[model samples]
Target chain A: MKLLELSGIGKRFGGLNALTDVSLHIGRGEIYGLIGPNGAGKTTLFNVITGLYQPDSGEFNFNGKRYRAAKPHVLAGAGIARTFQNIRLFANLTALENVMIGRHVRTRSGVMGSIMNSRAMRLEEKACRDKAGELLNLVGLKKPHQTLAKNLSYGEQRRLEIARALAMEPLLLALDEPAAGMNATETENLKELIEGIRNAGITVLLIEHDVKLIMGLCDRVAVLDYGRKIAEGVPDEVRNDPQVISAYLGVDGE
Target chain B: MPNAHEAGIFKRQRRRILLAAILLVLPFAVDGILGRGWLRIVDFAMLYIMLALGLNIVVGYAGLLDLGYIAFFAVGAYCYALSASPHLALAFPQLFPDGVHLSFLIVLPAAALLAGGMGVLLGAPTLKLRGDYLAIVTLGFGEIIRIFMNNLNAPVNLTNGPQGISRIDPISIAGLSLNATQRIFGITLPSVHLYFYLFLCFAGLVVFVSQRLEKSRIGRAWMAIREDEIAASAMGINTRNLKLLAFAMGAASGGISGTLFAGFQGFVSPESFSLMESVMVLCMVVLGGMGHIYGVILGGLLLALLPELLRHSVLPMQQALFGKTIIDPESLRMLLFGIALILVMLYRPAGLWPSRVRRRELSSDERPDETA
Candidate 1:
């Protein structure tokens, strides 16, 4: 079953067409990878899907609900959670607090409840703390839970961000350059983590510049170039497509 | 032996107890040391602490810069003034034939709600504006509210124009006016002392609410918005609703405190709620530590007392030294105070006690010493 589907998507920034006629779909529980070169509109596509940018024209469906232009929070509530190309963890917050904030959509406590600090509110808060703790452990942040997010190392911050997103418990998780600053060991850990997240029944949509990682990890691959889908198939088939190659290495005559 | 972590927690717990105990008796201690005039200063200081705690929700937790916070204070004050004073009787006449004077209990919550509603009104239009533009709009809002209060006398005489509303009824509970001194359990207490204790209780309540919010999911959501609104929204926290919530909650505190201020002074005036007062409150939040409750209270106290301290000590010293006075005491006070604040701020660039994240971000030199 398709968990997320985008069709006829178009986005523009002034005179430049950042993305045009971009369309794709991810089956439930599949690790789908998006690969493209610089200025390929890969991140822009992610932005359009995540409701950061209003598409010039397009429609997307998530869990059978159609959205022409969903607000960011609405998309999140509709089970689509994403991480940025650059990490955006609440730096001042504790690693645990960052994950707890991710549980915001799940938690039901309101202003009056929080101010009153009733027994039910206390229990809910404890549950949130416990869940946040588990998510941090899942992401392999073995540091103290009270460690501020800013104090985490580069790779740890990346993993913490993923933990925060996972805490949202989205049906489909979109990660943009999750291993951007990671080294060999950290990337290996991330691969295992994504697999773990998938095993937990969440479909994954990934954008990575590291072709080798994408090739080894993705169940399927889609290539984007010049704001359009150049090629998409099983990882091996998409990797062998001539258009995908030409997109990566430009056509010589042109 | 427990680890270093356990030791740190133990120490913090002990320190918290000690701090609470000191805060309990602080007013009486100040009264004994400096007399009624200084006690009045302490009372006003508590009110500013309430305002700072409220402003902290917007500026510190949600990371919204609001320069028109005093507008909420004015809204609250005017709300109480319009409903609970003879001025309201004069303005409406038909509504209250013999002059309406309501209990403080009724006025306080009414004013808070009015302020909260105004907060949402201000928040809705400026939702898209960020940073400096947001600050400018809020500043304009503050000025506009003040001007409205100043000129609403002719057509509808709402705020009594420049002369201000006087003889505002003091807060009374169960027919016992807090303004009157009564012998309680064989000890005679001054009316000011009674008001001191009452204001102390209000400040304590504000502290408790703030501390609770700081630990809960709502507080975390606010901090997340402060850190990154886009990321916060992406994480399923509604940025617009949460921003409005911050403004409303912050304004509620200002309103409640303003109601108390009116009851305390027996008056309400536009001069009390000014742009300069807004900046002063903002300074307290920044200097103490934006999100840290204790830091803000400390900031409120020190900044609130600085001018008074100068009036009593610095002015006398300067007069004695120069025979008459070489410089205007007010001008010299501003110069010394500004220089001192800058020096102190330079030493602790983030704040005296900034939230852990803010402190870490501001002081890169201290980063290498810590581990992840």
Candidate 2:
């Protein structure tokens, strides 16, 4: 079954075309990789999918239901969540508290119930804590649950962001440049983390510049050039595609 | 593990009891040693603590800058004055031939609801605004409310204009009026002491409510929004509703404190709710430590007492130094106070009682960039 279907997605900023006629589809639980050269609109596509920007002329479907525009929280409610290209963790909040916030939409304790803290509220709170702890452990962060997000190592912050997103229980998770600043060892760990996320039955859509990681992990690869999808196929076919090579290395080999 | 847990609980219980005992005996101890004037300062400090906690919900937890929070306090005071006092008896004599006097319980909630309603009203249109723009709008809202209080008397005689409303009924429990002295077991308790105890109880309640909020799911949502609004929304937390909730909750506390102020002072006026007063309350929240409850309370106490303490000591020092008052101590006090506050901020930017997370963030803020 198709988890997400986008057709003719177009977005513009004044005179600049950020994304144009971007059409794509991904089946449930597939690891889809999006690769592009600089200014190829990779992050813009993620923003559009996550409802940060409204597509000027396109409709997308989630679980076969069409939507033209929805608020970020509404998209999240419909099982769509994404990590930012820049890390956006709640810097002052404890790591556990950060993930617990992602658990907010799933829980239903209103202001009065929270203030009163009845049996039901306490139970829900305890359940949220346990679930968040499990997610933290899944992300391989252990024994420093109380540490602030800003205090976490660069690699741990990336993993913690994923954990926070997973706390939302998203059906399709979009990770934007998950291995931006990681060394080879850290990138190896991220590969396992993304595969683990897929093994858990969640669809993974990722944007990455690291060709090795993308070619190694993606079940299917899609390449974009100047806001247009130049090629799409299995990892090997797209990696050897002439159009993708010229787009990455430039037509005149500059 | 069980023994340690049980011992922790026991230690906490013992500390709570000791604190409660001190609080219970505080008014009498002050009355016996320091006299009534000083006790009144303590009472006002508690009231400001409630206001600071209320403002903390907006400025601290939710990260919305509100410059006009004192407007909610005015709304609350007016709500009580209109409902339970004869200030509007002549204007709406048909509704209350003898004036609609109500019990303390009735007007307290009424005032809170009224202020909370006003909060929503103000918050709805300005939901998209943030940072300095939000501050400007709220500051305007506060001034607008004050202007209405000053001018509403001419057209409707509702707020009695700048002359203000007087003769407000005192808060009472069951049948005992807090305004009147009571003889309990042949020991005459002064009315001021009664007011102090009542204010203390309400302050305790506010503290409890604030602490619960800081640990609850809703509190977590607010903090998330405070940290990163876009990421928070992406996590399925509704930013709009949470911001409104912060405003309403904060205003609700202001309303409660305002009602208490009306009852204790037995009067209400525009002068009592001014821009300076709003800034003073906000200062308590910021200087005490923006996101920490204990920090806010400590800030409130210190700021409230500092002026009174200055009043008592500044004149004596001046008299001894200059043989007479060379400059108005009030003016000099502001200069010294400003310098002291600047020094404190320079020394401890995270505040004297910062939340652990806030302290960590502030400390790390000075370090060189580590994240690539």
Candidate 3:
């Protein structure tokens, strides 16, 4: 079933059109990939979907609820979680603490509970910690309960970001360039982790530069160039499409 | 591992007991040895601790550098001043013929609620701004509040303006006044000593609340926002609401301290809530250790008492060296203070008692790149 539906999405940065008339339909438990050339508004579309940027003209429905100009946190509460293209971890906090922060939307405790040390607060705190620990382990982070996010290796940081997003218990997990800086083995592990996430009944939306990873992993693929969708189909169909070939492999390619 | 954990717990408890004993005896020890004037300084030190802890919630935990925190204190002070004193009687005799004399219990929450609401007012517009921009706005807020307090006398005479409000009622519990000496347990408790104990409880309560916040889920969310707002938001934190909550919580603490200050001094003045006072409180939070409660308390006590210690010693030392006082003591003390601040920043860039995160941040560059 379709979990997220966006129609005629358009975003502009001042005089420049970042994204135009973009439409996407993502189904539950499927790995959907968005691939594009530089400045094709891939990140902008990601930002719009995550509620970082308000789409100038468009509407989106997540889990059957329509939203307009939704704030990032509000979208987060609605079970949509995302990670940055360039990793944005809470560097000073422990890896476990980073995940615990993601549990904020799921948990409920206010200042009064914090001050009075209520029984409910104590129970919630323990549960939050336990959930965070499990997420860290799920992401294969070592010494994550004690080690700071900044101290972790690059690949580890990427995994930790995924873990943090997962801690939100999101219905849709949007990843921006998850395997950007990974070595071959790390990328392989990342692919497996993403598949595992999909298998566990969560929809995955990915923006990637790695065409091979996209072709190999995605159930469906969409290609964008010059702020417009050029072609969209399964990997085999998209790869042979003449418009995609022209935009991707031009007359005189880089 | 369990045995080791239990041993650690035992040691911590023992340390706490010893510290508690020292704290309980501190006012008496200072009174008997250094004099009663020193006890007054100690009492003010306790108040500063409360102020520093409040600011820490905003600056240290949430990473929102607020320079106008003293406005909340002023709000609290003025709230108590207007209600407890006879200023309102002269201004509006119809409403408060004998002056509105509210109990400490009632006025305390009232002041906190007022100041906290004001804090939300400040936080609302500035939520979109961060770093240096946020600081400049808050600085303006502090000055604006002070200017308002200075000018509110003409139209309605609500604040009594620059002259300030005096003869404010002392804090009383069930009818026992803190302003006067009372015989308790066969011991004569001076007014200053009584105030000291009350301030101690207030400071202790601030410390307790701060400690609880430091390790909680809310605290982690705050730190996450401090690290990166976008990431924090994506992590499902309501950044705007949390930032406002920080401001309100911090302001509430400031309000409580203000009520205590007005009660202890029996006076409220615009001069007491100056820009300089705000900066000094921020310094205590930063200089001691921004994120650590104990460090903030230590910073407050040191900064509060250091000037007094210098005032007492600097003159005598100058006189001894020159056979007459040569250099002005006030300027010399400030010069020493400036040098001390420079030295601390130079040697310990994080803070005197840096939190583990801060210490690691400062030292992170030493490790080789391991991203691969």
Number of the predicted model whose DockQ against the real structure is largest? 3
Give lDDT for model 2.
0.90
User: Which window of 10 residues has the lowest lDDT sum in candidate 1 chain B?
Assistant: B363-372
TM-score of 3: 0.97
In order, what lDDT does every prediction score? 0.87, 0.90, 0.90
Model 1 C-alpha lDDT per residue in residues B298-367, reported as the tens digit of each score = 8898888888887787767877887766666578767886886797688876668776666656764465
Q: Better model by lDDT, 1 or 2?
A: 2
What is the DockQ (computed on Cα atoms) for candidate 2? 0.70
Assign candidate 2 its CAPRI class.
Answer: medium
Residue A63, model 1, lDDT: 95
lDDT of 3 by residue, A138-248 (tens): 989875477888888888999999999999999999999999988899999999999999999889999999999999999999998888998898999999888888887
lDDT of 3 by residue, B201-220 (tens): 87888888888988888888
lDDT of 2 by residue, A1-254 (tens): 89999999999999989889999999999999999999999888889999988889887998788887888898899998789889999998999999999898789998788779888999999999999999999999864898889888888899999999999899999999999989998999899999999999999999998999999999898898889998999999997888988998777633
Worst 10 residues of 2 chain B by lDDT: B363-372
Would you list the rank order by lDDT, best first?
Answer: 3, 2, 1
- Each candidate's number of clashing pairs is 1, 0, 0
For each candidate, give the TM-score of chain B.
0.92, 0.95, 0.96
Q: Candidate 1, after superposition: displacement of residue A204 in Å? A: 0.8
Candidates sorted by DockQ, descending order?
3, 2, 1
Which residue pairs of candidate 2 clash? none
DockQ, every prediction? 0.63, 0.70, 0.81
